[model samples]
Target: MNLSSSLMACLALAPLAQGARLSDRLESAHGRFLDDRRGAFTSLSDPFGVPPLAKIVLEDPRGRFSGPESWHRNVVSTVFWVGELPSENNPTPNTASAWDGNWQANFGGYDHPEKRDGFLPTGFVPALNPFYIALPYNDIGRDGRHRPEASTVIPWFWEDYRGEGISVCKDRWVAIHHEGRVCYAQWEDVGPFETDHFQYVFGKDAPRPNRNQNAGIDLSPAVRDFLGLRSGESVEWRFTHDREVPAGPWRDWSPEPGLPRR
Candidate 1:
C-alpha cells in the first residue's frame, strides 16, 4: 500500500487495540511514562492547553514566563516554515526550492542573536530546579502513515549556571515530555558532550553578562582551526553520563555485546 493508505490503516487500527478510548489510552500511557520530578526550574509543563497563536499575543505580550509553550508556538514558528495544507483555499508548494524560499522568509531575517538572550527569558522564573528542555524528533519518518525507522533526535537544555546564557547540551538519552511528565530513554553508554555556544559570535551583538562559561566553550585554537569552526560559529557540546541500564524494555539493547554496562 502507499504511504497515505498505510497511515490510514494505522489510524484506523489505533482505536481497536485496547479497551480504553484513544484519549484515555493517551492519558494513561502518558501518566505511566512521563516524569515531572526535576524541581521548580524545569519547564516540564503541558503544551496542549496553550492558547492559539493569535490568542497568546493578545493575552500576554511578554509571554507568561518561558516554557515549552514559548518554545513550540513562538520559537519553532519563528524558526521553521510551517507548511500549508491542501485545502480549497490553499495550494501546496510545488518544489523544494519554493519551500526553501518560504522557509527563508519565515526565519531568515529574525534577529536570532537578540532571541538568544540568556537562555530563558529575563523575567521568567523557572518552576523546577536543574531545568531541562527535551527535544525529540523522528529522524526516519516521512510526513504520513509509515512506521518510523530506528532513529531518534534527542537534545536537552540544562541550567548549570546562574547567568543569562542557558547552557544547552546534547545527551544520548531520549528525552521526552508529555502531559506534564518527562521520560528519558537511558543510553547504554554515554555519548560525548556537545554544547551549543553560538551567543558569543555576534560581538557587541552578543547578549550581555557573558561571564558564564557553561553556555559557551573555550576550545583550543588548534582544535577550532581543525574543525573549521570560526570564532562566532555556533557550537554545541555533547557529553555522556555514567549510569547502568535499568532493567526494563531497553535491557537487551546495548552499545556492544559483553561490554561493561555503563
Candidate 2:
C-alpha cells in the first residue's frame, strides 16, 4: 500500500491522541536506517529507498492516528514472534541458538566473509543473510540446550531482495526455523495496494517441507495451491510440519504432467 493508505489503515486501527508530538528523534533514526546491504541482490529499482525500520504507532486515547508514543520512540522496542519452521530440512543447532534472546543482543552471532565498516559492530553479522544468522529473536539465557518458545520485541533489519533489488520491511512478520534461520512471507489481502497486502521475493532453491511424500511433493505447487495464488504473484508464507502424520500420506496438487490428482 502507498504511504497515505497505510497511514489511513493504521489510523483506523488506533487513532492518534490530541497534542501528541511526533518524535523527531525516531523520524531521524528511521531516515538514516539502511534498508538493505550495499552489495546484496534484489529486484526493486531502489533497494535502499525503503525504510529499514518502522515505528509501531499505537492508538492514542483520542482514538486517532496522531503522533509518536514511547514505544515508537525507543528504536529497539520493536518485537517479533517466532513462527514454525518452513521446511523438513531442519536447521542445525547453531541455527536455532542464534534466535535465543533479544535480536539485537545476538547481532554478531554469525560470521561472514565480506565485512562492512561503519555503524555496524565490529563482530556484527547481518541477520538478513540467512547463510550466516538464521532468524531474529531474543534469548532468555545461554545455559541449557533446550529450545524455548517465547516472544520478544527488538530492533529488526531487512535483507536485500534477491534480484528484485527491494528489501523486506521491518513491519512484516517473519518465519523462524528451529535452527534460528528466518524467511519472509506475506499475508493475504484484497489487492496489491490493500493495507494488509505485502510483496515478497523468495530465494531460489528454498526448502519445502515433505509432510506427505506420497502426496507428490513440490514446494512451488503446494505453496501456490495452499495460498490460492496466481501466476507471477508475490506472497508471504510460513510452513508448519505435522509430525503426527507420515510424510508420504499428505495430499497436494500436482504440477507435473500426467501426475495423479491429489
Candidate 3:
C-alpha cells in the first residue's frame, strides 16, 4: 500500500497539534490536504496556520494488486493446543500430529494459553517455535501415503519436499489477520475439520462445510494469544514466504528442534 504525496505530507505533519481531541485534531489536519488546493494552504486551524487534515484513503498505487496475495478472507478459525485432549468436534488428541507422532513431546508440553509463561506452556520452554497453525490440507494421507495431487496442488511442493516420510507443508509460514492485527505462525499440523481440500487451500474455492462451525484453520495457543483471538472466530489468512515474515515472536524460536532460531 502506497500513500499519495499530499496525504503523506499531511500525515508527516500530524504531530503539530498537541491538545484535546487528538483524533479530531489529526482528522482536521488530514482533511486539509483533501479539501484544500493541491499543495496549497487554505485556513488556519492551528497556531502554525496549517489546514485541517483530510480523510486518508488507503489503496494500491498501481490500481491493481499482484496475483500472489491470495488471502482466504473471513474464514472461521478454532483454537487447538499441542497436547489438547480429544473433543467432540476433534476426535483425535493433538498429542500426535499428522506428520510428527511425538508432537506433544517435541513441543515440550501442552501449550495451554490460559496456563502460560509468556507465549509458551508453563513449566517448560518449547523445543520449537510455539507460534503454529493448522490449515485444512495435509499433503500426506492417513494411510502413510502421499496425496497424488500434493506436487501439483502445493505451490512450492517440488522445491521443499525432502522425501516420503518428510512433509513440505510442515513449518510453512502463514500470516493471519484479525481486525487490524496480523500474527504470523508456522504450519505444523492439519485440520479444524477437513484436510485435502486443495481447492480452498491453494485455489480460489472456499472452505468446505464442517461440524465445527465450518472452521477452515486451527490456531495454536501462541497464535491465539498474539492475535487476541477466541476459540471460534473469523480471520483472514494467506501463505507467506519464510523470508517475507517480518521479525516477531513467531521467529523467536527455532522451527526444528536443536536448530537455530528461524
Task: Name the candidate that leads on TM-score.
Answer: 3
TM-score of 1: 0.17
All candidates in order of TM-score, best leading = 3, 1, 2
Better of 2 and 3 by lDDT: 3
Most lDDT-accurate candidate: 3
Candidate 1 global CA lDDT score: 0.27
Residue-level lDDT of model 1, residues 40-156, one tens digit each, is 336646433565466332222222122333221111100111222333312332111121334323322222212333322133322211111212221212332211222111112
Q: lDDT by residue for model 3 over 1-262, one digit each (tens)?
A: 2357767677666666556476775696678666645434444335355676897844321211124457889899999988889889888789998889999998887788689887878988888788989988889987776788987777677667688846888888888999899998888888877778999888778789989888899998888888998988999998877556787777768646333332
User: Mind giving the per-residue lDDT tens digits that candidate 2 earns over 1-262?
Assistant: 5655644444444424575445643443344332223234466666658766678754222211122221111011101112213334332222222323343333334322123233122364333222111222212224422213211111121121222212222222322221222222221111111111111111112222122321211122212332343333332223222221122212221234333121
Error of 1 at 126 (Å): 4.3
Query: What TM-score goes with each of the models?
Result: 0.17, 0.14, 0.70
